[model samples]
Target: MLWLSCVDETAPALPAAWLIATDAQPANLPERSALRRSLACKVLARQFGLPDAAVEIGHEPAGRPLILAPQGSGLHLSLATRSGLVAIALAPRPVGVDVEQVAPASEPPLAMLHPEERRWLASLPASARPETFAQLWSAKEAYVKALGIGFARAPESFAVRLDGAGRFVVDGARNGGPASGFVRLTKNGGHESMAAAFIVLDQA
Candidate 1:
């Protein structure tokens, strides 16, 4: 199953189980993202009828969080957050998700894009580039994370095609597999376009 959750980062009310799960996570962890992840696990476990305590969270050497409870269950999940929004994807196979918010003043490194991607962006008007950059970047990140290698898996090693607005298809993967996405223009404070990508990898 696939799930996407938009958690309000305003310290909103949480279920008692989730609160305990969140508190059980390491304190003074330094990154607020970690807390959000813990909460995400609790939320996901609830949906699966697994008690929060039955879930054990560990980490890969590459720093990716490993959901360690109920071993051999063949379940996997991924989480992403940005600007007070948390996105999660759950699947029976490996999965990855990414949330990217556009900023007009953004200056992204060109090295992140493959040559074909660079050309695609160059073809767009300057006004379209920033959000497109975020969209493309998020898709690549999502794909690599789904592979469970994180950034250690080179995103540029494969290719992804942006199929118009808010859609991505993995170009080089077997028969061009598709990745799901959600995109919208937000006027929260300033005009910005944000996107979320959910990716499932090819079987090993």
Candidate 2:
């Protein structure tokens, strides 16, 4: 299951594997760190039936967050923050989540995408390109993060494209195939809009 909440709202009881997005942006780095820790603790406590104080957040050398105290819980998580929104994904296997603010751009940097993705973008009407680009970019970001390599692999090395039925698919990487997740566009109040994607990978 997936949950979306504002920072001031309470998180619903989530499943063992879930994804969450919050409109919680602290003003500074320290506050953001605290917010992440707090949210992780709450989610872990409920999911594992442990006391909140027993939950600890740690980082891999490459900077992915991990459960430190209850080390054998077999849970995986990924996070992304952008434009005042924070997204967290937890799962039994590897999971990745990314959120990007949607903004108009007359000429998006198509070179950063795989050649096939660029062609797909070029085929769309000019007016629709910006939102489409945001969706594709968020999906790619989430996919790479799920692999735990981040940009260590070039963005151009793989493609996230729409199939004929309008579903997103990942292609061109070693593990490239049908992507097992979704990209969604969300409206935050009146003026702010965001695109977020959640991906679950079979292999770690």
- What does candidate 1's lDDT look like per residue over 1-204, in tens digits? 223233222222211111111212233444546755666766656665676777776767766556787676566667665654455665666677776777668665557788888888888888888888887887888777777677775666666677776557776663245544433333211223556677666563
Model 2: lDDT to the true structure:
0.72
- RMSD to native, candidate 1: 6.7
Each candidate: what lDDT? Answer: 0.60, 0.72
Residue 94 displacement (Å), model 2? 1.3
Candidate 2, residues 33-60, lDDT tens digits: the string is 6766787677667666778898888989
Root-mean-square deviation of Cα positions for candidate 2 versus the true structure, in angstroms:
3.5
Model 1 clash tally, residue pairs: 0
Highest TM-score against the true fold, candidate: 2
Residue 34 miss distance in model 1 (angstroms)? 2.0
The local lDDT score (0 to 100) that residue 112 gets in candidate 2 is: 97
Candidate 2: pairs in clash: none
